[model samples]
Target chain A: MPREVRERQMLDAAVATFARHGYRAASMDGIAELAGVSKPLVYLYLNSKEDLFTACIRREAAALVRAVRHGVDPATPPDRQLWEGLGAFFTHTAEHPDGWAVLHNQARTSGEPFAREVATMRADLVAFVTELIAAAAREAHDDPELGDREVAGLAHALVGAAESLAGWADTDGSVTAKEAASTLMNFAWAGLGNLMEGERWTPR
Target chain B: MPREVRERQMLDAAVATFARHGYRAASMDGIAELAGVSKPLVYLYLNSKEDLFTACIRREAAALVRAVRHGVDPATPPDRQLWEGLGAFFTHTAEHPDGWAVLHNQARTSGEPFAREVATMRADLVAFVTELIAAAAREAHDDPELGDREVAGLAHALVGAAESLAGWADTDGSVTAKEAASTLMNFAWAGLGNLMEGERWTPR
Candidate 1:
C-alpha cells in the first residue's frame, strides 16, 4: 500500500486506539499493530508517542473547527447561526465519535501539552460564541450594554451548553443531530430576554 | 486529632493527590506522604486506592448536591431556584477545588465503578434541573408543553453549562463564583421565551 494511504490508515487506527485507551495507555506498538504496520514504520511516519498524539489532536481539532465554521451561515441572524452551528457540532461528533473522544475526553486528560493544544480549540469555540453574543447585543440593543466580563461568562455558558448536549447526544445515539440541536435551542433561547418579560415555564 | 478529623484529613489528601495525578496514576504512598502519615496508616483509614477514591467521590458528590439543594428554595420560582442552585454549585466548586476535581475531572475519566458512582450524583442534579425546567414550562404555558425527552435534554444543557463554567472558573481563578453563576444565568436563562421570536447568539 502507498505511504499516504498507510499514513491515513495509521491515523484512523490511532484515533480509535487513543479514544479507547487515552494517550499514556496507548502505545505506538499497539497503534501500529492495529494499523497493520510495523512499529518501526509507525515510528517512521509519526516519530514519538507524544508527536503522534499531538498529530491526532491537531487532526481532530482542525476537523471540528472546520465543520462548525463552514456549517453555519455568517449572514443569518444570530439564532439561526447558532442553530446551524450546533447542528454542525452534533453531526461532526456523531460522524467522528473517535475524533470527538480524542479531543474532548483524551486530550485534556492526557496532561498539559495536549490539554493546551485542545484548549486552543476550546478557546476558538468560546471566541465564536463570544462574538455571536456581542453581535446579538449590537443588533438587539444597538449598543454593547453587556460588559466584557459578562460577555465572557455568556460565551463560556454557551459553549458549555453545547458541550453538555454533545455528550448527551453522544451517549444516546438514538437522538438525531437536528433534534438535539433544536432541543438545545429551545432550552437556551426559549427563556431568554428577561428584559422583555419573564417567559418562565412551570410544572403541572 | 480525633478519628473523624484524621479520617477527613486522609480523605482530603487522597482526593487532592488523585485529582492531580489521576486515578490510575495516583499512588497510595503519595497520598499518605501528602497526608503526613505512613502508607500503612493511610491504608488503615481508607483501605485501598479504590476505596479511597470512592470515598472521595461520595464525599464531594454529597457536598455538591447538598450545596446546590441548600441554595435553592422549593417555594421560589423555578428560575430563581436554578439561579440559586447555580450559585451554590459555583461556590462549592470554588471552595472545594480539589474535591470538585475529583468529582468532575477525575471521576468522569476514571471509568467503571467510579464513573457510575459520580453518575448518581450527576443524575440527581440533572433531575432537579429537569423538574425545574418542566415546572417553569407548566407555570408559563399553564400546561405541559416540554415533554420528558425534551426536559431531559434541557437538563443536560443546564448541567453541562454548570459543569463547563465550573471548570472555567477553576482554571480562570480570577473569575469568582458569583460571576460564573451570573454568566451562566445570562447565557442560559436570557431570551428563552423568545422561541417564537427566534433569537440566538452566533459568531458574527
Candidate 2:
C-alpha cells in the first residue's frame, strides 16, 4: 500500500487504541499491532507516541470542524444555521464515536501538547458560535447589543452544553442525533432569543 | 494529630497530587510526602491507592454538596435559590481549586470507581437543578409544562454550563464567584423562564 493509505490506517488504529486504553497506557507496539504494521514502520511514519497522539488529535479535530462547517448553509437564517450545525455535530460524533472520544475525553486529559490542540479546535468552534449569536442578535430588530465578553460566555456555555448532550446521546443509543440537536436548540436558542430581546431573568 | 485530622490532611494532599499529576502518574509516596507523613503511616491510614483516591473524591464531593445545600434557602423563590446555590458552588470551587480540578478533570478521566463517585455527586446536583427548573415552570402559572426528559436535558445543560464557567473563572482571576454565577443566571435563567412561559424560538 501507498504511504498515505498506510498512514491513514495507522491513525485509525491509533485513535481506537488511545480511546480505549487512554494516552499513558497506550503503547506504540499496541498501535502498530492494531495497524497491522511493523513497530519500526509505525515509528518511521509517526515518529513517537506523543507525535502519534498529536496526529490523531489534529485529524479528528479537523474532521469534526469539517462536518459542522459542511452542515451549515451560509444562506440560511441564523437559527437554521445553528440548528443545522448542531445536527451535523451530533451525527458526526455518533458516527465516529472513537474519534469523538479521542478529541473530547482523551486529548484534553493527556497533557499540555494534546490539550492545547483540542483547545484550539474548541476556540475555533466557540468563535463560530459567537458570530452566529451576534448575527442572530442583529437579525432581531432593535435588540440590545451584546457585549463581546457576554457573547463569548454564551458561546462557551452553548458549546459545553452541546458537548455534554453529545456524551449523553452517545451513552444512550436510543437517543437520536436529531433529538439531541432539537433538545439543545430548545434549551439554548430560545434562551439566546430571550437574551437578545432583553428579557432578563432577575433574582426575586 | 488525631486520626480524623490525619485523615483529612492525607485527603487534602491526595487531591492536590492527583489534580496536578493525574491518577495514573500520581503516587501514594508523593501524597504521603506532601502530607508530611511517612509512606507506611499513609498506607495504614488510607489503605491502598484506590481507597485513598476514593476517599479524596468522597470528601470533595460532600464538601461541594454541602456548600450548595447550605447556600440555598427554601423560603426564597426558585430563582433566588438557584442563584444562591450557584454562588456557593463557584465560591467553593474557587476556594478549593485543587479539589475542583480533582472532581471535574481528574476523577472523571480516571477509571470506573473514581468516575462513578464523581458521577453520583453530579447526579445529585443535576437532580437539584431539575427540581428548581420544575419549580420555576410551576411559578409561571398555566404555561405549557416541560416534559420530564426536557427538564432533565435543561438541567444537564445548566450543570455543564456551570462547570465550563467554573473552569474559565478559575483560569482568569479577575472573574469573581459572584460574577460567574450572575453571568450563568443571565445566560440560562432567562431562557428557562421564557421556555416556561411558552415562548419558544423556532427556525424561520
Candidate 3:
C-alpha cells in the first residue's frame, strides 16, 4: 500500500492501542502488530512513542473539530448553530468512542506535551462557543455585555457539560445524541439568556 | 508513631506519589521512602498497590464530602447551601491539590476498581446537587417537576463544570476559591432557576 494509506492504518492501530492500554502501557510493537505492519515500519513512519501518541491526538482532534464545524451553519441563529454543533459532537463521539476516549481520557492524563495538545483543541472549541454566545447577546440587544471572563467561564462550562454528557451517553446506549444535545441546550441556553437579561441567581 | 498516625502518613505519601507519577509508575518502594516507613511495613499496612490506591481514594473522597457538608448549613435555603458547599469544595481541592488529582485524574483513569470508587463519591455529590435543584424548583411553585433524567443531566453538568473550574483555578493562582465558587453559582443557578419558572431558551 501507499505511504499515506500505511500511515492511516498505523494511526488507527495506535488510537485503538492507546485507548485500550493507555499511553504508558501501549507499545510500538503492539501497535505495529495491530496495524499489520512490521515494527521497523511503525518506527519508520511514526518515529517514537511520544510522536505516535501526538499523531493520534492531532488526527482525532482535527476530526472532531471538522465534525462540529460541518454540522454548524454560519447563516443560522446562534442557538440553532449551537444546537447543530452539539448534535454533531455527540454523533461523532458516539460513532468514534475510542477516538473520544483518546482525546478526553488518555491525552489529558499523559505528560505535558500530549496534555497541551488536547488543551489547544479544547481552547479552540471554547472560543467557538464564546463567539456564538456573544452573537446571541448582540441579537438580543442586551444592555450590558457579558464580561470576557464571564463568557470564557460560560464556554468552559458549556464544553465541560457537553463532554460529561457525551461520556454518559456513550456508557448508556439508550441515551441518544439528540437527547444529550437537547438536554444541554435546555440546561445551558436558558441560563445564558437569563444572564444576558441581567437576571442573576444570588445566594439567599 | 501510633499505627493510625503511621497509616495516615503512608496514605499521604501514596497520594503524592500517585499524583506525580501515576498509578503504574508509582511503586511501593517510592511510597515507603516518602512515608519514611519500611517497605514491608508499607505492604503490611496497605496490602498492595491497588489497596493503597483504594485507601487513598476513600480517604480523599471522605475528606471532600466532609468539607462540603461542613460548609453548608441545613437551615439555610438550598441556594445558600449550594453556594457554601461549592466554596468548601474549591477550598479543599485547592489546598489538597495532590489528593484532588489522585481522585479526579489518576484514580478515574487507572481502571474499573479505582474508577468505581471515585464514581460512588461522584454519585453522592450529584445526588446532593440534584436535591438542591429539586428544592429550588419546589420553592418556585413551578408548573411541573423536572424529570429524573433531566435533573440528573443538570446535576452532572453542574458537577462537570465545577470540576473543570477547579482545574482552571488550580492552574491560575489568582483565581481564589471564593471566586471560583461565585462564578459557578452565577453560571449554574440562574439557568436552573429560570428552568424552574417555566422560562425556556429555544432555537430561533
Which candidate's lDDT is highest? Answer: 2
Ranking 2 against 3 by TM-score, winner: 2
Q: Which ten contiguous residues of candidate 3 chain A have the minimum total lDDT?
A: A141-150
Candidate No. with top TM-score: 2
Task: Give stretches of model 3 more than 4 Å off.
Answer: A21-40, A48-50, A110-112, A134-145, B24-40, B73-75, B138-145
Query: Candidates 1 and 2: which is better by TM-score?
Result: 2
Q: Clash totals for all models, in order?
A: 22, 0, 0
Candidate 1: tens digits of C-alpha lDDT, residues A1-204 = 888899999999999999998887888888999999999998899998899899999999999999999988889987777778888988999899999999988887666688899989999999987787667667767555676666677667768878878888888888878878887766565444342132333322
Tens-digit lDDT string for candidate 2 (B106-152)? 88877677889998999899898888888777777656478777887
User: Against the true structure, what is each candidate's TM-score?
Assistant: 0.88, 0.90, 0.87
By lDDT, rank the candidates, best first. 2, 3, 1
lDDT (C-alpha) at residue A68 in model 2: 93
Q: Compute fnat per model.
A: 0.62, 0.62, 0.59
Residue pairs in collision within model 2:
none
Which DockQ value does candidate 1 get? 0.48
Q: Answer with 1 or 3, whichever has the higher lDDT.
A: 3
How many steric overlaps does candidate 1 have? 22
For candidate 2, the clash count comes to: 0
